[model samples]
Target: MKFASLDPASVSPRRSRRLWPWLLLSPLLLIAIAATLAVQSRPLVEPVDGGLKPEEIQSTKDFLRRNDPRRLQASPHRLLRIEERQLNLMLMQLAQRYGQGRGAAQIQLQAGTARLQASLQMPALGVWLNLEARLSQTLALPQVEELRLGHLPLPAWLAEAALRRGLGHLALSVQAQRAGELVESLRFNPQELLLGYHWQADSLDHVLGAFWTPDEQERAQAYNRRLVEISAAYPPGSSVSLALLMPPIFELARARSERPDADPVAENRAALLTLALFSTGQRWSKLLPSARAWPQPLPRMVTLAGRDDFPQHFLVSAVLALEGSGPLADAIGVYKEVADSRGGSGFSFNDIAADRAGTRFGLLAKDAPRSLQALMRVGLHELDFMPGVADLPEFLSAEAFQQRYGGIDAPAYRQMMAEIEARIAALPLLQQANVPRL
Candidate 1:
């Protein structure tokens, strides 16, 4: 059979017209394509080494605590020093907190300037927004010398204009103004930045308080006070079952939720924060310096299944899971255990199980914050979130871990992991979170 061919006379004029429109659109279309290609599908910046380390977190807290204008006065001659790593750590914390755990930041200092590079994922488009900025000092005040977005290098004048525009926008925000008043100067070194600040009374408070809202602060303080009350009878240095402590705070959350204006998510978040802080043997004052003056939380070793380490692993990981992602929470838990195996207390699958349980609890908290608060109001037990851990291996040194389980990719290690996942899957409380099988 022969194929039929269209005659010139039979061709539609509409098709010809569409071809002309494409010519008209070619320039824009090409530019759009280029931009899309330039913006990477994967994040460009390398993550800070040892993602969210404890010492870095403590450094962040200590920095805030020392410079808290409400509590301490700054000296005119003294300049506060912060490491490049600390700045990056704070950036990572902000990324995890607000970026859905989808960004990384790195600062490379050179003499008097810093090369700040960061990347953030725009999930809706599945593209990363890469940013690079050259920061310099002008009369001890921080200033931007250049800025680049994605693959496009903005002109120096345009960067200056953008910086001016940014400063103007920041001026409109009262919180920014308060924060700005505290920045007197910035001098940079290869590895650190020196900051000079005026003694602006309450400036730090105003700035930090804007983030830690008064309403949220009340929720946090209320939980902390109630927890203090619960810890009082246990004696200062004695151990308390996390089981015994969870009920009263969550019951308070439920009671609060009955009110028409109660925010269940916020309630649960506050409760988790309070409990995690207590379980980890930390105080709310770590973040909010003013809280240092609040009623002291009684010293108590909170335990899960009579093991103190379990509560720290569980509750803190739960908090991370609530704020970040399950994978991040899980990775952090594993990282801690692996780190321990190297030299610390030795690797413990028992603690890993607790971490997995806490992660599930946190995942559920994220999925249905109110439902979790409502469900946990009555009672909590080890069996509710965690399965039996005594049979699991613990206190294994790196050599021992290698000798027995091989490694994480090995069959033995994977079998143990599957067992842990199976145990977590069986938890009714975690089941309510609609956890996806890992």
Candidate 2:
């Protein structure tokens, strides 16, 4: 877990600000809380059947393979196959995450129907809320045959309505709903399930906007717009280095930081987001649709170590870490390189190095924003954050990749990864105070 230091001066005032909202909404809040308590008053199903078994968990490589980045640009329709064991393991992982180690989830698939069951522990009330949803036919076009909350079976529509209402208050529900709409097909078998989806980019900015205030959104947009201007100054098709933009952008952040009541972390996050996206050849409109009206970012071959692909791997992973989790970003990075080995550019450890660098930089910007700001106030050299690409292996075919390094869990792969990690740790940028090696 992580923690934030509390400010004594702000505690009372923050509590004071919070009182009005709670007081005004007390009636609705109480009603909702009461309804929830009534529905989950007792355990309808056995709670915590089999604890999460480490032996039953899927291999980490299998987990990593799910984040393949090639899916981002693949055809609209795609299929994913999972067996019963994998599904249950995935559920166990999810329950551990959302159920705070006190819950369990299991799915039993057979014939044309599936049964999904879950039990969650209520805080301070020691009660287990059990639910089971029965679905017939396809998960893509889901048909809810039965819905049970605790021991009470309810009409499908009633449960659907209740769920819709409950989902409105969840912070990530919008993203989840948007993502679910992309499912294209589903087939359930006695032993396995086949799930297919359309690959469409969901605007993460829109998803994250749920947490940002209007002012924060506008501030991020301003940085994106500045990047457009920065791109315009360079010639199209020529090489553009992120070095050209980082210092200037962070200087803007520093200026904003000097203003009263400004949050240095948020400022630094916005600047990093802008730089990473623009340097990667991505359209700003993808970040925010209003960016469509902004000047076009001129085309340039963003290069590091004289290779155009390095920038894409680096900046993309950086921004992923900035907005998401570091482990997730790292796994996705590996997936990209693995996908490349399959008849694309082949695998390249150099690119992996770049991806690692980006992840660390993103983490630094996220966890040590004030320290990042102080460094940016001075200047940035390419070598500080992204040092020289070592003489690592590159451009190996799939067969060669497997023969030489085996899989990601192989000792050879891990040794090379360790070398890459050490290189990143030695960078002058990460060497600075408060900067961490991811």
Candidate 3:
């Protein structure tokens, strides 16, 4: 019985040893078998580097081909259909290059009754650029209106160029319509449709050419020149740019021509008043006595007044008097007339008290007769008799006026007088006045 038990134990150990060997070798054995089978079934496998495989490249090419809907052949008369994706991509490139990190939404193109409409939203600027181009005309006159180009942080140079050159997309729309109409209505040489863009600002128009021929360098130079000219003409404190001054200047010019008394001081005052009215939307005619005198004072004022009979003649008379050899003389006469009517003596005095009290000219006091005398002593200076006293402080205190008319070493009082004189001389009537013999 002992011999039988020992024999059974020996058998068990042998089985265990056999199972351990199989478990360890199974993984390695299976891998070797797979490798050997692969080698025998196919040719030796080549090492693949980092590049795409031939099949993968082929698949990419196929995908592009499938997506491309408008693959037009090279032909003289070809109606190329550009897919929305393609247009959007092109616009994306443009926006990336010029826009301030703003992405553009999908562009929509549609055929209208007589034109083509291309619309897109600019995400960066929060504005929509809608281009409606006439497709029927041969010359292709595209009128581009700004639906909303304000939100974009447009570079000044770009803005100026835009004013000069037509906006590219809008121009293209017009050309497309023309081309379409030409294709449908008339027979002519079929040329490739050209696209362009332009800006409404004069500075931009000269700078940014249409897409077909964008002269970027030239436009930039032109913009710089314009900026320099504007700076020189308006040097700080002189006045705003001529463009800003145009409305008032034009109105004054027209009034001078139409009025019987074209008083430069009065005209200047009127111009100022008109400008104030325009800015504030307030009627100031009630502040003056001769609101209805003759030859309407200024066109804008007349527009503001909504009246037919304006003081054009009085303005003309004032202008003639101011322009004559005696501008100060004319002013003095007007002042005296006003003062005398109010029972005040028309005499040059350090202080004049009116007999009558409470009316516009009832009480009179001279704050600085010495300053006035000093200005009058300078033969080149002329002071306005009517409303002339009110602008004295501005003339005295403004640095710009002082720089132009007063010497640097002059006393403050002298500078003030000189500035006042210079302002008076700048008036059209006073400018025409003969220099008094000192």
Give candidate 1 regions above 4 Å deviation: 1-42, 46-98, 151-183, 188-211, 228-239, 280-283, 289-300, 325-328, 377-379, 406-415
lDDT, model 1, position 139? 80
Cα error of candidate 3 at position 250, Å: 56
Off by over 4 Å in 2: 1-170, 174-216, 257-265, 377-379
lDDT of 3 by residue, 1-438 (tens): 355444655668779888888999999998776444322221111112211222333343454585432343323343333444454444443332233222232334433112223334445444445433323323343232222232222333453355445435334543343333433222112222223222122322222222222332232232223333433554443323212432334343344535564333433333333333323323333332222232222212221112111122122332222222122222233344333333443221111111010011100102221222222221221122221333333212234423543422357635554554444444432223333311
Cα shift from native, residue 77, model 3 (Å): 2.8
Per-prediction TM-score to the true structure, in the order listed: 0.71, 0.61, 0.18
Better of 1 and 2 by TM-score: 1
Put the candidates in TM-score order, highest first: 1, 2, 3
Say which prediction, candidate 2 or candidate 3, comes out ahead on lDDT: 2
lDDT of 2 at 74: 60
| Candidate 2 residue lDDT tens string, 1-438 | 889887767678778798889898999997776556446765543444434332333253455467553534566677777888788777765565455455678888988988888877787776677888988885456577898877567788786676676466444466567656666777788968888776645434444334555776778777876776777887766786666667778878878888888887788778876666666667656666656677666766766767677777777777767664566566667776777787788888988899999888877877877677677644567788785776889888889999999977799999999999998999877888546454
Cα lDDT, model 1, residue 421: 87
Question: What do the candidate models score in CA lDDT, each in turn?
Answer: 0.77, 0.72, 0.31
Candidates sorted on lDDT, descending: 1, 2, 3
Candidate 2 TM-score, C-alpha based: 0.61
Point to the candidate with the largest lDDT.
1
| Residue-level lDDT for 156 in candidate 1 | 69
